[model samples]
Target: MCARIIRSLLVVCASLAVAANASAGQVQVAVAANFTAPMQAIASEFEKDTGHSVQASYGATGQFYAQISNGAPFEVFLSADDSTPAKLEKEGQSVEGSRFTYAIGKLVLWSPKEGVVDDKGAVLEKGDFKHLSIANPKAAPYGLAATQTLDKLGLSDTLKGKIVEGQNITQALQFVSTGNAELGLVALSQVYKDGQITAGSVWVVPEAMYQPIRQDALILKKGADNPAAEALVEYLKGPKAAEIIKAYGYTL
Candidate 1:
């Protein structure tokens, strides 16, 4: 009876060891949609440096906030706007003093078809398109920028009912790409990346049109001591990651 018990105990210990080994080398990240492409590039570099695997979930800022609050097991959050992380820190979901601006987002007007969005400011005011797409301003930073740009350019009222709102920037881009909408307001990173332009006419929105979209990162309290989380932040601030982000058309 004693010999049989010892064997069972050894088997249980081996299973636990395997589970620990699998998780010990990985990090969990929640990233905003706007930074998806660049984050993938950064992840490769981070893994190369620290031998740590990274798993990231991407979505709208508000949607991600909901996920984090519901106790989704994420170690870090890279927000498209600084406010979400600030709110998380204040709400005790993330470590205070760990939130910092990591990148600046740029807004753009783009279309997948020719002559859909003239780079000139006239198209918005011209009001010829049947459908214009923007991410939901309530949940997306890029959506907020799109609204602000219209207000600044005195085109909001003229373009109001013509708008089709998407749940997130990714969806917003899809609305235009799928030919459901003629034009859209989307993140610069998605339009011009990998040394190529998406199939579209793009107008890089002027920085002066809205508040600076200062993107921020936070180390969630669940992972304050995670080695993978620490290494990721360091890698993001390094040269290779910065180059990748810049290539995606975001400002440092």
Candidate 2:
């Protein structure tokens, strides 16, 4: 009698497990390169907690916008700047009420070699570096911020010849990390972890130098009815995700 009861319990547990697996869903997410680390961590946690999986693609906001406009299969977008998502909403590409600010990004001038960048960002005026990397201002918001900072300091023309443009912020940072450029203006979150910079030297650009980097998230029209998309959106706004975002040096 005891063996029969145990077997029955095992059968019921197996059924429950099968049901859970059957209901699991997957959401395709297009994420800004700068938010790559935090989003990866959050996605892992979301899957574990909710039994849904996230398939994420990282790239520049402008590039993603162009792709989405061309009918890409992405269901959700985590943009580096709020304007892109807002523009998508205006264009009817994303769900109107699904937009919200997820994080505020900070721009940083960084170099892999210690002491290459000063705290006050005077390195630009010095003009001693061979190459200074920045993302394509036309495609990356952080690139725009970098240009604005140089403009505010009246160094844009002086540094114009030294500027090397990357396709995106990740590539911009790569230029610095790989010694293709001595330094780069990139997202703080890329090099920051555990409440501090991960390596090298950095100067956090003053917020006043450029417009606020209000990163926003939105569910695209394709994801309007997707349970995984909705769940991922709510998970991003929850405390666990907020903690991870903050830990990566972003403002909630």
Candidate 3:
């Protein structure tokens, strides 16, 4: 009787260990640079609410897309534009029909110097600044939006010589914040807090100036079988995640 009881206890312990190991597995995510802060916030809450952890790599969405196509081991992708995920799904790199818009982002022309940027973004027209930084239009969705806005305003040709391009939106913002550039076109969420600009002058570009930045999230083919990745994707669409995203100046 005693031997049977001990064997039953060992079996239960082994099963419990397996379950714990599965719950502790991490989800690997590739996130766009523009969504850096929000993704960090979301990842923290996700890890706390669920025992699953997330390891996130942040960079330009275009670069991530290229990496994914080349078989990057990311389980999830949070993009700065909806198109990239849709393209990935079409290419069969992402789980079929597993992509969805997580947030809508805003573009802003910003200057760290007080009064350097105006509400109407006339600074771009004035062209007084020595340098204007923007992300590489070919590699970043926000950069593409900035390029579109400049084209819409007929400043593309005029501003060509004065433009300095960064690899990603985060780098573009760094150029402005560090005074490497007098002004920059960057993500609004990076400079906003409590419905206001934080320590900078910002012109929130009108939506009509460029295409809407509909950010999307996708479950990659590598993560289709990962429970943690699927749970994180669902969490991003939940009420808690929406609140956090909205707090960062993003729209649902």
Candidate 4:
């Protein structure tokens, strides 16, 4: 009698597991490097609430655009700049009317070592550092903003030889964290938490110095029929994701 009851319980559990698996879906996402932390947190919450899983690939937005254009399998894209998604929509690479601004990014000049950067960002003009890191301006919007800030401050030509370029914003932060570069111009979301810089010294770049970094999210053409893709897009615009984005210091 005991063995029979145990077997029956096992069968019921298996059936329930199968039902759960049948309902759950997965979405592939291409994310910008700067938004990695918040996206991961949001993805976790999204999965818990919706029973859907997210597979995220992080990199420069320009590179992701090229890949998506060439038919990459990503169902959704969270770009570092609004212009990239606009271009994709214009070229028919993304689902029509599915794009929206998700977050506005902030740039910062930071050093992992305390006191290396000042609140006023006078370090660039002081020229006390050997290597200053930034993302590749051609591929990363934050890099373009950094350049713009430098130009506005009249320090671009003066600091050219001292600059070291990273492939993306994350790598640019790494260069500073690892001591390879004494200072880096990187996305604020990379180091901020709870309305403060989590580590090191930082100078938050003023918005007037550069173009606003308007990050956008959209479903790709390939994701038109994927329910998980549509769900994830809506989730990003929901209250839960907005809280997470704000906690990471991104303006939603």
Best by lDDT: 4
Per residue, candidate 3 scores C-alpha lDDT tens digits across 151-181 of 9999999999989999999999999888899
lDDT of 2 by residue, 208-240 (tens): 999899999999999998999999999999999
Give the candidates in order of TM-score, highest first. Answer: 2, 4, 3, 1
Instruction: Supply the global lDDT for candidate 1.
Output: 0.87
Q: Write the per-residue lDDT of candidate 4 for residues 38-137, one digit (tens) a residue.
A: 9999999999999999999999998898899898999999999999999999998989999999999999999998998999999999999899999999
Best by TM-score: 2
**Prediction 1 TM-score vs. true:** 0.87
Report RMSD for candidate 4. 1.7
lDDT of 4 at 147: 97
Output the TM-score of candidate 4.
0.95
Is 3 or 4 the stronger prediction by TM-score? 4
Cα shift from native, residue 134, model 4 (Å): 0.5
Which digits, one per residue and each the tens of the lDDT, describe model 1 over residues 1-252? Answer: 999999999999999878766755788999999898899988987777667889988889989998899998999999989888989998998876778788998898898866666666578887888988999999999999999999999889988989999999999998998989988989989888866666768888889998899999989988888878877877788889889988998878
Output the better candidate (1/4) by lDDT: 4
Q: lDDT: which is higher, 2 or 3?
A: 2
lDDT of each: 0.87, 0.94, 0.92, 0.94
User: Model 3 segments beyond 4 Å from truth?
Assistant: 1-22
Candidate 2 worst ten-residue window by lDDT:
121-130
Worst 10 residues of 3 by lDDT: 192-201
Q: Which 10 consecutive residues of model 1 have the lowest summed lDDT?
A: 113-122
